[model samples]
Target: MLLLSACGGSSGNAGGSGGSSDDVLSLALENTLPGWDWRKQISAGHVGLEWRPVYDTLLRTRTDGTVVPNAAEKYSYNEDKTVLTLKMRAGMKFTDGAPVDARAAKFSLEGFRDGGGADSLRLAGVKVHVVDDLTLTLTLPAPNPALISYLGGSCGQLVSPASLDSPTLATKPIGSGPYVLNTRATVTGSKFVFNRNPDYWNPDDFPYDKVEFLVMADETAQLNALSTGQIDGAEISLGSIERAKSTGLRVDSFPNVWSGLFFLDRAGTKIPALGDVRVRKAINMVFDRSAIAEGIWNGNGVANSQTYGPISPAFQKDLVDHYPYDIKAAQRLMKEAGYADGFSITLPEVDHYNDEYSAIAVQQLAKLNIRAEVVSVPRQESISRILGGEFPMFVYKMPVNPEAEQVSNVLGPKGAFNPYHSEDPELNKLLAKWTVADGDQAAKVYQEINRFLVEKAWFAPFGNPDLPWAFNGSTTISGTLGTTPPLYAFK
Candidate 1:
């Protein structure tokens, strides 16, 4: 991929497009954004650009794990959590100066549902109804347990009703966000320059007068820009933390993603050894999760070997030690399962995680007589190999979403990644309980389901890697501080 030449003057020690003022904040992202269309933008690279500055969600999630209203000033739901009613703030307007009212609210929410995007799954069976200028109601065919959380996410964001029909809005967005795109100053697909939205309802929230987003596919390039002052901030990997802080950049880190092996052939469809539960347990018992998390991930990840991160709402500390590294015990189990000499399996080559983790697993599993073969292929081809069920094990990073409906699709019966597309009657029942239940009720149900996965050895979760973010200086952007810029507060 070709990179755009940096605009403005020398990479000075200041900020802004030309390094002239702090009002203009420039940041670097690891990948180029797909586009400005929220319904179509699924990558995390474009989240911050969409969530806080370019668009506004009906609800917003804070760093402290609270979900509150943003564009929708207040909201309510029925007892079963089926019907949702949203009451908008008195005076919000799109960048085009169009009033953001109930009709526009319905249009935006329904737009996402029918947009054929990744998020449409969240809005399944959702129907939007406009009640009045400031009120809109969302009806669901059944209880949507994760409705509030989704409403607080990218899928629930509202675009400008004025520009909803414009084909250009896909490449160029117009929302009631804190910033407005300055097309003349932007080099589409490379860098986007946004001036503070003067007509924005919440202009006082984002302190910066200007903001610039640069798309650099190279991590080293992002850090280089951060070092030379070409950009004020860059989201980097754990490998770059010490190097970045050494250069006097402020590093802000958090837990963002979980990594692990998905045993796709649990029923022994492709790998007969996996049909036996002992084989799977033996695999889990073979990992020194702590060492791998500390050494390979560089202390940037937690050692909890479960799909759910320690910070996740569904996490149960008692289950954190579900798997212990005991090579002798693992070997014994393998022998009992008739794989004493070990078995070989193919894993897709995922450059980011698979290559390194699989290499480490090979060295460890060798003690148990397990032979591992990792094949390198294009990213999509590797994904197809797993989705097509041509492989036994898959290595990748997946979000530990607390939503039962969402989590179930990946780990439940008919789960996309479940080994052999397996199903546990009791576990499925618990997942059903979790979906309709919240708070302590839901947590209890999820606890049972999580424990079952561990006891059954359904997954070998490697835990969430700590994410690192380094910024040159601080501005008034206050709220969640990770990759996704949810809500901002002006100084």
Candidate 2:
């Protein structure tokens, strides 16, 4: 659950410290935003999430986990769970004064359905029907109980019809959000200023008037800037949590619903060492999750074996005790796998977690007779290379929905996560049950799948680190932070 700080009122406005008449709020991050075009890419760094301030979804999720209407004033469902109707607020317009009527909503959704160059493959199957100037209908091919959660996702955000028609709008998005993009600067560093949208639709709900984002790709530079007060807040680095807290800055951290690999092994790969399931389990047994959580994250991480959490009532808690660090048992397994001689394996650069943490893994795994070769690369190139099958083992952080159906996106056919080529008829069978089963059955099925992943040694489930952030004592931003922080409420 999210713990809202009853700290005094935000410095001033939703944009920055309230007392300051200057509407320009400066923010800083540790990396350059991948792109400004929300509809053109997925995982475009924090800025794309920042775009939530520019784009509006049909519904909004509050820090309390309640859903509220945003662009749409109301939405209803039919008895059969096939048709969903959304009603938009009348007289709404984008920042450029372009009417954000039902027609524009229809066009934007249709464009996404027809591949609007946006990275929205999850919504590829949705069929939309505009009922009238005030109502929009979504007709699903089959009954989907989790559709509401999907609608509340970042990819479901609405775009302007004029922007959809104009190809150059990617460079300058015109949104119905509370803040409008002011200047997009990219010289020595990347920066953008957001001015208050005076004609914003929800004045009572949105509090801030302006906000600024500065991209600082270098970790050292981001830390320096935060200490010098050049920026208000930043995502906490692994080794800097204690330092941040000691400075009187608020350090907020929580266990995210995310999982990463300590190691991965694909069957029939060149590295015969990884082909042995016992060897993989041996490595998992030797992994020191507690040390990583304490030494690296400064006690701001959660020890997890699999991905699901209590947030999803369906999460299986039995799996929590599946793996524990036992060097003796690991060595026994290593000997049983005919690797008493210890073989060499490449520990490629993983871009998902703190680079220093991955380095720590390489050092720790060496004690158990598994000789590791470490290689580092840029984050983008590293992701592309790993997904393209460049290395045998790698690490990645996956942001997943808290539902069994959406969880299939990773383990399903052609899914990005089946990197080890793990396939089972029974596993596929359970995924198909998502359409017909309710929460109880879905939980059982996902539990079965979790057991399968563990037994097969498909991937070692390590700790799910709590996402930590350090904000200036004077500035405040609203949103619940998890694996992937919801950015819609970030004013």
Clashes of each: 3, 5
Q: Give lDDT tens digits, candidate 2, residues 240-333.
A: 7777767666766655445456343446376687788888888778767677667665676566666655454445677665779888999888
lDDT of all predictions, in order shown? 0.68, 0.61
Q: Could you tell me the TM-score of candidate 2? A: 0.81
Worst 10-residue lDDT window, candidate 2: 1-10
Worst 10 residues of 1 by lDDT: 1-10
Off by over 4 Å in 1: 1-20, 43-52, 161-164, 263-276, 331-358, 361-393, 400-423, 475-491
Q: How much does candidate 1 score in TM-score?
A: 0.82
Q: Local error of candidate 1 at 151, Å?
A: 1.2
**Model 2 clashing residue pairs (backbone):** 11-18, 12-17, 12-18, 14-208, 15-208
lDDT of 1 by residue, 153-194 (tens): 666677877666888976678777767778888896688787
Give the TM-score of each candidate.
Answer: 0.82, 0.81
